[model samples]
Target chain A: MKLHELTIHEASDLLKKREISSQELTRAVLDRIESVEKKVDAYITIAGETAVKQAELADREISRGNISPLTGIPVSVKDLICTKGLRTTCASKILENFTPQYDAFVIKKLKKAGAVIVGKTNMDEFAMGSSTENSGMKTTRNPWDLTCIPGGSSGGSAAAVAADMCLGSLGSDTGGSIRQPASHCGVVGMKPTYGRVSRFGLVAFASSLDQIGPLAKDVLDCALLMNAIAGYDPADSTSVPEDVPDYTSFSNKGLSGMTIGIPKEYNETKGLDPEVSGAVKNAVKVIEDLGAKCVEITLPHTKYAVAAYYVIAPSEASSNLARYDGVKYGFRDKEKNSLIDMYRSTRTKGFGAEVQRRIILGTYSLSSGYYDAYYKKASQVRTLIMEDFKNAFKSCDLILSPVAPTPAFKIGEKIDDPLTMYLSDIFTLSANLAGIPGISVPCGFSSAGLPIGLQLIGRHFEEKKILTAAYNFEQATDFHKQKPEI
Target chain B: MKITKDEVVYTADLARLDLSENSINRFADQIGDILEYVDTLNSVDTEGITPTSHAIFLSNAFREDEVKESMGADKALANAPEKEDGNFIVPKVINL
Candidate 1:
């Protein structure tokens, strides 16, 4: 295999044996990015020089027998995560030129493990949209079909992994940002349970719903990335003070004694493409064949997930994003003389249409009179949704469904219709609403030659159960082995 | 559930975002449709349920208030659009 094509574990093994230097691996990946970036547009900032420097450092660390599973492996990060001295735009024009003075807790962890930082990938502006077309930066195309979107907010990260621009990448999930894109891009993506991963320096969208996780070529790679990044941090109060398991230790043990739930509501969901449904059904059969018992369960509030999410996510987003006024860092409107005018003008010019729309929606929802009807009501329904997950987990260890209603759509297919675009995330949003861990694993391809994903959701902080199940399925099927011919 | 243009304009003002007349009309329609969709939540029986503001509940994170090394003025103001004398400069906040 080519150097850039190696998974994190594979590359780590080679690096530990002194069979290949980190420099050679990093260069090959950089060369691959340089060659295919125009076709994919998967990155906002390609840190070629820094990646080389980090690789050299990784080589030094490896020679001293200080190698971790991620040591000497090149990986990409979504643009939203703060990286010291590297520009972190969150794919928004407001913070386009802003560079963080400190690394995010996850970035610090990656650096400590000696992983080579490749570059920053593109996403929806402030992670506001399902498709990456909302990104203020360049468009990222699916490597499987250049005409299609690579699924989004984490579009660029998933595309980078699928196209072999990097071994594994970090992507944040807020309402299916990572998993949906990973599904569309035919890669493995996991949204660790909320509070399972610290969000100390993640550019916040919805503080309660956002969690940074991993996107990789397969389930094992996803597990390796999870092991390195998941832990409690005092900096984020929301981070649960629980022990993070050794995610990599979950081997493909045939899923015995496991009971998987298939939500009846999800099976009856509207707009579920037959191809996606077929793929998920096949995945369930595969799990059953591997000694797992499949049962039908109901998350009755599943239909309201998208509705509740739109209100709650935007409501929190408006508050979290209020820090972008002209007083401090990021863009400022120089023409405005008054403080309010500067704030208004700077935001008007700096934010994109989708972002402005969200701000308006959020503000309206949280407005004095409407708060009880919108934000508060949504929160109450959120309570109901959480209860539904709690109830369902009593009967099943994991919930299985299609990651998305359909496979990757064309670039401009749903951009103009925001409501239509929101419905695409129907299958994935409930997990976020309930703060459960979810993984998207490639199960099959559509008749149109696009990949479909099988989503496995576990109770909050039960990442090991889902990872083990996903690994067992991945081992049984060759779907993850099929790479997009970029 | 129809979001009027005036509401969009008013909310934009509240959010400190100035939108164009064209965008105002566009957002009014788009946001109207989205709000109408979100109105589906109105049908759910949520009475007597406590609102969940956060998924994972935790008490206030407390720590010793020790003076630690900060990022410093230089680094903090490094990305500021306008800065001088180790501070960020902005439009005058008060008019005497």
Candidate 2:
């Protein structure tokens, strides 16, 4: 059996009922990783012994009558998230060997919930790039189409889930790293509301925009993982103080009376493929068929989302990434004879060119002279975009759109043109900038056979609403049923 | 989307990424083009609208000052490329 394809809820039931041990599930995922990870390149660090130990512990716990929703399920952490003793590279060479002394807030929660972490998935360096191609490690290929990319930063997590390497995985989304890859790989990815999930253990990328979310093959599985991870952490000041409910309840009622809003500004963008647009439109129809009301809402400042994000994210990135000087922590070059030379050489070698470019842009925007012209203005515009959503949400419960302009593009297609690469994030960046919950659920595949995703956005802290809509749509469609041929 | 090598050097300096003349020239052309394309957003009239940075409506998420439990030194150094005295070891930086 392809055990990794089973949802966490499904696998946990069997394990809890004593049908199979947690170690069996862990070994199945590990065996699949051993057999398939070479082609997918989904993991930068695969934890075999630790995973086995955790599974054994979980098995013992289950035998001792310990049962939890997440018990005995194998999950992967995006390499950007600190995994206690595991190397959290963020796919950057500078931190290639740096391991954190503490578990990220989500890690602590998952461990408590009995999730057996299988491995650390690959990601774009510091969660910067939109394509896994920008990761200093090997490019993470989309399980759906090996020639194409798995969307990025969180590409490895998405690819791993789709390829059946893990039942579910954690992915940090800054500008759609989680959702875009989920779209590219034909899986489910959820970027929980900012502060909905604590950010304590995630290596900072764009601090304001970065969020650790779940990516799985189905909406329920994503919810199962999110429930374990989403809660306030004292370490992250941005963590919310609100109560987190069992989000799986949304799957029961579906999308009745939910207003699915379609933003008009998103429809008029250039490069939006007709096929992908049609798929989202059809998904909307399916949602309506399930008794939800589809409405047209306007987020007037939508056009400025990308521009505002470009300035804000880069500026934050510039500040957040400053800690990686060769002198402090992580890899320092043995060749550098001088401190300055070491700083330059270590950073130059550690970071990919794309990450370097953003850090520079961010630094420039935040520089003494240019700060007012860029960073401040971007922050001001950030408020405007928030207002637009605030107004739009007055009439609707959620927003629907395409996750990417098209299905997964071939590897190396837009890497040379940073603008084209930036444009790839256009559909995804708005949610991050707004700090709202966004998910990409499988809507359908394109004519060329690449998987397409339907983006569902919800009000801040209203992830249950979005997941409910997604779960209902998933029930009415066959998109999630189609697995990768690999 | 035209960019000059000087702009590349300027941005690199701002980013603290020291680059060679060759890399500067290469990134200049690429980043410059991206900047130009992104300029399309300028046409958007954000005149009165406040920019949005986070999606969660809640603010003031700061945590109370308190020490939390941490991993033990041996486990913490599991991925350290260099370690000594149960801490991450690095080249001397700021002299104490």
Top model number, lDDT: 1
On residues A1-486, what C-alpha lDDT tens digit does candidate 1 reach at each position?
899998888888899899999999999999999999999999999999999999999999888899999998999999999999999999998999999999999999999988989999999999888779999998999999999999988999999999999999999999999999999999999999999999998999999899999999989899999999999898898888898888989867699999999999987888999888999889989999999999999999989999999999999999998999967889898999998999999999999999988888998999999999999999999999999999999999999999999999999999999999999999889888888899999999999889999999998889999999999999999998888887
Please write out the lDDT profile of model 2 over residues A262-376, one tens digit for every residue.
Answer: 8998889999999999998889888888988888989877777777788888889888987777654687776865566676777888888888888877877777776766777
Candidate 2 local distance difference test against the native:
0.84
* Alpha-carbon TM-score of each model against the true structure: 0.99, 0.94
Off by over 4 Å in 1: none
Among incorrect, acceptable, medium and high, the docking class of model 2 is acceptable
- Isolated chain A: TM-score per model? 0.99, 0.98
DockQ-based CAPRI category assigned to the predicted complex of candidate 1: high
Q: How much is the lDDT of residue A320 in candidate 2? A: 90
The 10-residue segment with the lowest total lDDT in model 2 chain B: B50-59
Clashing pairs in 1: none
Any runs in candidate 2 off by more than 4 Å, and if so which? B1-3, B44-96
